[model samples]
Target: MKIFLTGLGFVGSKLVTHLIQSPENQLRVVSRSPSATLPAGVHFEQVDSLEKVINWPTLIGDSQVVIHTAARVHVMNDSCDDPLEEYRKVNVRGTLALAEAAAAVGVKRFVFVSSIKVNGEETFPETPYKADDVPAPRDPYGISKLEAEQALQALSSSSGMEVVIVRPVLVYGPRVRANFYNMMNWLFKGVPLPLGAINNKRSLVSIYNLVDFIGVCAKHPRAANQTFLISDGQDLSTTELLQKMGRALGVSVRLLPVPVSMLKLTASIVGKSGISQRLCGFLQVDIEKNRRLLDWVPVCSVEEGLARTAQDFLTGRRA
Candidate 1:
């Protein structure tokens, strides 16, 4: 099948590489600038104008599927006064424009890479997030992603496009950044972290697993107009993650047990209660839908993934 993908960033680059090597698929990538250095089989185009680039018949004329991966990711150090508006323009508006373009063309399938943040930050004991869960995005980025989901759903109904949304949590592997880099930096420095006492569970996904799921979504019959929350299916605590990462790095994890209350107080004083809550909270997701519908599970285990990630970090492979 011929597929067109937008955004050749980390996840997009990985997906494009896999698609290019696959004998069954032909891939094209669209970006704001024609600056992506992709593999031999992949094609690239610089699409500065969303409207002109996404005219349905033009964008999906020969393509059977279109995967929209381009978006303004959450910037932790952004200088924008209204980050939400900025996010809305790139995430929400760009998505809507692309969907309209896909609908105008004859594309049969449209896959959207959404975030699990659409369900909210933390999950409760009795109820983990499900596909049917009403979206309750708290932050600007999450809100923009959820808004894009809604807009895409509407387009699916009106445009007869098979829209599939995959919401993956904390995607990690080689060439990651932000919080994952922070964790790696701590490990590289061999710093004693105060996370032993925190037993909060979180769901994480390996990059390979996420890319595989997207491949399934592209053609699976049951994936039409469906939303899927994917993960590695292991809810590990902070300590467990640190320990595993340390093992992957050939080092012993050194965790100092500080009182949870004291840690919370310190975070509050620094106005980082959000960071504190995530560090000391439970956020588990149920991936039963992916298993039940598509019979999909992570092919790469956490141990394998972490080992690869550690090697990649040590080798200094940049995105």
Candidate 2:
């Protein structure tokens, strides 16, 4: 199977590593930099911009599957005047352009690595989000992803190109960064956090599990034209997650049982409502579709995944 991959970021690089382990997969990666350290026997192409017009037919030639992992991710301290348009330029326009080119070149399947935010920012305690839920993107990043999914679906409908969309929750693993990594760092340092009272449930996926699922989707016959909501198949509260992280790091966490309502009020007063919401919000996904339809299960357990990540962080493998 000839596979063309985009974005050599954390997820893309890991996916490349996993795919190259199989001799049957002929991998080609596109990066903006010429100095990317790709595995042996894999081909590389350099492209300055995904939104710019390029020779797509040649780029996607002989590739049976195109896995798009490149996107304009969420910007916390955005400086742009119109963040949505900025995001659209890369995530929406660039993604659709690549898909169009891949379809034009007769790619067998297009696997789009989407975000769970497309379903919504948060879910209710009793009601988990299903794959078939109507999209209600609240943020610019989520809106862009939803638009890209819609565009890909339209393209797949118009053309005969099979499309598989995987909306994954917070992906954490060896090279993990952002809020999850920060939480791990806080746990490693035994920082007392005001999240003991946060009983909100959040679903997360390990990078290993996500890459495994992508590999399955790449070749699974039943995955064609399907949208999947993937997770670790386990929901955890903020306190539980921090405690697990502490255990992974071989340390004990100190959690302060601050009132959830007081925390929200203080966060709102300090203009940190977003952070508070993420720390005290419910965001669970129902991954039954992936399990039942494709008979897929997570390759790494949450504990194992967290341990690996903590070990990597401790050893300075991911700093």
lDDT by residue (1-319, candidate 1, tens digit) is 9998988777888898777767989887887756557777777777775534545456556888999888888776568999999888888887888777777767899999999889999987646788888889888999999999989888888889899999989999988988998898798788999888887789999999999999999989999999999889888888889989998887778899997888899999999998898888878889899999998888889899899999888888343
The number of residue pairs in model 2 that clash at the backbone is: 0
The best candidate by lDDT is: 2
Encode model 2's per-residue lDDT on 1-319: one tens digit a residue: 9999998888999999999999899998886656367789988888898888478778888999999998888889788999999999999999998999999888999999999999998998979999999999998999999999999999999999999999999999987888888888888777888889888899999999999999999999999999999999989999899888898898989999999999999999999999888999999999999999999988899999999998999988345
Identify the runs in model 1 with alpha carbons over 4 angstroms from their true place. 33-36, 49-59, 317-319
| Residue pairs in candidate 2 whose N, alpha carbon or C atoms collide under 3 angstroms | none
**TM-scores across all candidates?**
0.94, 0.97
* Candidates in order: C-alpha RMSD to true structure: 2.1, 1.4
Q: Which 10 residues in a row give candidate 1 its minimum summed lDDT?
A: 50-59
Candidate that would win on TM-score: 2
Error of 2 at 99 (Å): 1.0
Error of 2 at 41 (Å): 0.7
lDDT assessment of candidate 2: 0.91
State, as a TM-score between 0 and 1, how close model 1 is to the true structure: 0.94
